[model samples]
Target: MQQIIAAAIQFNVQQGDVEANLSHVRDALARVADRGAQLAVLPELWSTGFAYRTLTELAQRTDAVVAELQELSVRHNLVIVGSQPEPAGDNRVFNTIHVIDRGRIAATYRKLHLFSLLGEDTAFKGGERWCLAETSLGKIGVIICYDLRFPELSRRLALEGADLICVPAQWPKPRQEHWRTLLRARAIENQLPVVAANACGLIGKLDFFGMSMVIDHCGEVLADAGERPGEVLATLDRQAMTAWRAQIPCFADRRPDLY
Candidate 1:
C-alpha cells in the first residue's frame, strides 16, 4: 500500500488569545482536510500560544479546546494532534499533547522536559509518562517542543515500534539551527519519520521561527516551511521506512544490555 500523508501547520499564534488561537487551529484542521491529509499536526501550546506570562489564567479553558479538536477530527475524518495547558486537578497544571482519532482522545503525552528558560517550570507541572498511540498508519509517538532535544525519548519510542514521531513545538527563532539539526538526528538514528509543527512570528517577547518540516527515516528533508506561518505536507511511506531499516539494520543490531 502507499504511504499516509500528514500535514504540519505552522501557525502564527497570538499570545494569550485563546479564542483567536483556537479559531486558527480549527482553520488549520480544515485546510489539512481540504488537502486530503490523513493526519493534521498543530504547534505546541496552541490554545494559548505558550503564554507563560498568563498560563494560569488560561489553564481552565484547555478542555474546551480539546473538545473542539475532537469535534474537528470526527467531522473531517482526520487524526488531529495538538497541545494545550492541562489542568491536572488538585491545583496542578501541565503542558499536554493530545492525539485525537475518530472523535476520541487516543493518547495524551504530557511534556516531560519543561523549558526552564521559558519559566515553564514555574507555571506548569511536568509529566512522568511517555505515551504512544496506534493508528491505521502505524505506531505514532508524540512530544512537545523541548522534548525534541532529548534523543532518549525519541529513541525509546522508536524502539517501541513508532514509525512516526510527531512533535508540536513553539520553538523560538534565534535557535533555528538547533531545531533543524535535532529533528534530523532523531529521524536518522531512529529510522523513523519525524513530523514537526512549529509556531511562527512573535508570542509575547519570544519570536518563533517556524521551520516546520517532515523528515524521512534517512534524515532527508521531505517537506519544509519557512520562518512564516504556513502548512507543509509529506507522504510518509511505510514501505520506504521498511526499506531503510532493512538496509541499515540499526534496530536489529541494538545491544540494549550494554546501555
Candidate 2:
C-alpha cells in the first residue's frame, strides 16, 4: 500500500499579527511533524488572521513566507501548504497558497474565488489561473476558502491529473455546514482525496468553526478536528484510490463532446 500521513493544522489565528501567527504556525508544524505527518496544511490568511483593515499592512512579500516555509520543510522533512496576504505588484494584495515540499517551493496558487460577503473582492485581487503541483506523494491541487464552492475549479484540477486537493480556509461558523458538505461532495464527485485546514476561534467580529477534515475518494471522513484548535491526521492509501478509480472508471467515462 502506498500510504502517506497527512495532517490538517487547525488553530486560532491572531488578527493583524504576522510574527505571532507565524510563530504559532511553526509550532503547529512541529507538532504535526512529531506525530509523523509527511504533509502539513495550514489555514488561509494564516499570517494575518483575516484582518481586513490592515491586510495590506500585514501582507508579506512572497519571498519572506517562502523562505520561512523552506526552512521549516527542511527541518521537519515534510510538505507544507498554506496561504498568506501577498502583494500583487500594483498595490493589490492577493490571498495566495504556497506549496513547499522538502525545502523547495513546488507551486503557488492565488485564490480565484473571493468571498463577497467578507469584502474579499474589494480588499484582495482574485487569481486568474489554476495550478497543480507534483509532489512525492502525488499530484496535488490547491485552492483557497471560497474556491471550494466552485466545482468547476476542482473538476479542472481533477482532469489535469490531481489525485488530492488541499483547501486552506478561514470559514466562519454561520457556514460550517457548507464547509463540511462541500469537502465531502468534492471528494465523492471527483473520486479523489480532499484535505482541508481551517482556522478556529474569533477573528474580529466573525467566529470561525474549526472542523478540519480529511475525506477520502468515497467521501469517508478519515479524521476531523471537531470545533477545536488541533491537528487531525489521516493516512491516505494511493493504491486503494487507484484501484477504486479503475473499478469505477469515472474519468474514462467522461464525455466532453456534448458539453
Candidate 3:
C-alpha cells in the first residue's frame, strides 16, 4: 500500500428504484474519479435499500448492475466496493459486497453478520466466510453495516495482513455515536486505514444519518461527510501508518494464548 486518495460516496438510496440509484452512483463516481480518487466506497444495499418484500425479485438484476459498475471502474480507472442483494436458493438472498478493481471483480464478500434488529436474519442468509480483496492498490478487508460491532471480524482481517478496511454501511440514527466510535476503534486497534460509506436522508420510517468517514491508523478523522449526501476524501499514507504501528507496537504485543 502506498499514498492513495480514497473516497466515501454517501447518498440517499430510493427504495426499490435501482435505476435512480444507479444513475446517482454513476454521476457521483464520475466526480469522485475526477477528484483523483483511486478507490471509491459506496453504501450497503446501494441498489435497493432493504426493500424486504421484493428483495428476491430485485436481486435478479444484480448482475446487470455489476456490469455497469465494471464499465464505470474501467472508464475511471478506479476500484469500487459496495454491497448488493444476491439471489439465494429457496427465495432468499445474500447481502454480498462486490470488490471491482478496474473492470475486474477482485473479490466478492458475503456479509457474515446479519442485523437481527431489523429482522435481517429472518429475511437473508449470512455468509460462513469473510473476504479480503487483494487488489493492485492493496489488500482490502471488506465488511458490511452491522459487522462493525464485531471486533473479532476486523481483528481476523488484521491478522490476515490487510492494508486497509473498506466498510459499506447503511447505519441509521439513534446510534450515530456507535457508528463513529466503532469505525475509529477498528482503525486504531488494527493499525490500518478505514474508508466507510453510509447513507443519508429518510428511508421508509427510518432516518439514516450519513457520517461517512475516512480514518487513519491512529484513529484520526481525515475526512467526514457529516449527515448529508456527499463524498469524503482523504489521502491514506502507508508510510505514516507503518510508522505509527511501529511507534505503538500494539499488534506485536498481543497475548492471545492467555485468553
Instruction: Give the top-scoring candidate (TM-score).
Output: 3
Write the residue-wise lDDT of candidate 3 on 98-175 in tens digits. 999999999999999999989999889999898998998999999999999999999999999899999999999989
lDDT of each: 0.86, 0.89, 0.94
| lDDT at residue 238 of model 1 (Cα atoms) | 86
Winner by TM-score between candidate 3 and candidate 1:
3
Clashes of 2: 0
In candidate 2, residue 91 scores what lDDT? Answer: 59
lDDT of 1: 0.86
Per-residue lDDT of model 2, residues 111-210, tens digit only: 9998898678888899999999888777899999889999999999999999799999999988889999999999988999999999999888889999
- TM-score per model over all chains: 0.96, 0.97, 0.99
- Candidate scoring better on TM-score of 2 and 3: 3
Model 1 TM-score, all chains together: 0.96
lDDT (tens digit, per residue) of candidate 1 on 52-102: 656777888888778878898889888888788888764557889888986
Q: What count of clashes does model 3 give?
A: 0
